[model samples]
Target: MTKKRNMWNILLASPFILAVLTCFIVNFALDRQFSWSLLTAASCLYAYLMLYTLIFGGKHRILFTYLVLAILLIPFLYIIEYTANLYLPQPIYWTTRLGIPVSLAWLAALAVTALLKTLTHANGFLTTGYFILAFYAAERCTNNRIDAFIGPNDSWSLSDHYPILYFSAAALFLLLGLITTAVKRSRSRA
Candidate 1:
């Protein structure tokens, strides 16, 4: 029974492990550069732990509250960062750079929150699936609308390859969601 329980634990954790590994592989393959900030890393680690606990630690209500808090905090944090950037002496371009790390932290929070909620609610597949759809829609909308705000002198072009790239990413997330659902279902049957 102990061994079986261990196996179950491993199975339950596999999706998150796979997601982390895939992120590493993609980062390496794409030669993407990411700054390893301590704050961001800590946020991610805490989020992961909270998510795991929320899913399997029997603290469902507390975890759900944390998830809700995280979701609400993300936009508020962004606004704070934006306000800070405006008052600082740094160039406007630096806002994007500074914001990216904070945004990533928020995104990690969101993902973990979602994962916790989905697991507890037994709606992992639906939550992840809809998240992808929402992401795609937001990406499309942002890409189309952003051009209007940028001046001609701005070096950034809204016509870049982001739309296709984001669409492909959405597809990948959808596939991952499907796989995670299958795993969860199989585990439940065992």
Candidate 2:
């Protein structure tokens, strides 16, 4: 069984290897340089890592996947910036100022997701609440980063950026989860 699983893992990895090879070959053939293929290789590596981690991560799959993402994302973004700067006509430097922070924000969101999953123990309402709250937070963080990058295109208003409805819904869902858990515990005790 272990041998078969290993074989299957190898098979799963084959496509990513093929894609990377193809990208490198095509890139070098067309451009006589290996610039763009770096991006492809980096992307394939990240994808394979995430896939492998998720598949073999067992009960801790979510946490493992999140760790893989958190660890690899910034380096991946760096590769992106390196490739873009090298290949593009003009260098629009945004990696440190925009990409990293936004990625961190999303990572924080994922952390919250993992936390919620653990906390809820598959209670649906809690998961929904956490997801909604994380989504709102990530989106708001992204918009804030963009606003910072662009530098005051228009006058900023709190209402324009914030999703009050989503926040409220998330709060409601959390309340529901708490009530449900309490009632469940009370019944179990009785």
**CA deviation > 4 Å runs, candidate 2:** 116-122, 155-162
- Top candidate (lDDT): 2
Give the per-residue Cα lDDT of candidate 1 at 135: 54
Q: Over the stretch 98-166, how does candidate 1's per-residue lDDT look in tens digits?
A: 444444544564565476556656355546555655555544444444443353334443225455665
Q: Against the unseen true structure, what C-alpha lDDT does each candidate score?
A: 0.54, 0.87
lDDT of 2 by residue, 75-94 (tens): 99999999999967999889
Predictions: Cα RMSD each: 13.2, 2.4
Report the CA-based lDDT of candidate 1 relative to the real structure.
0.54
Best by TM-score: 2
Each prediction's number of clashing residue pairs: 0, 0
Candidates' TM-scores?
A: 0.30, 0.87
**In model 1, where do residues sit more than 4 Å from their true spots?**
1-146, 150-159
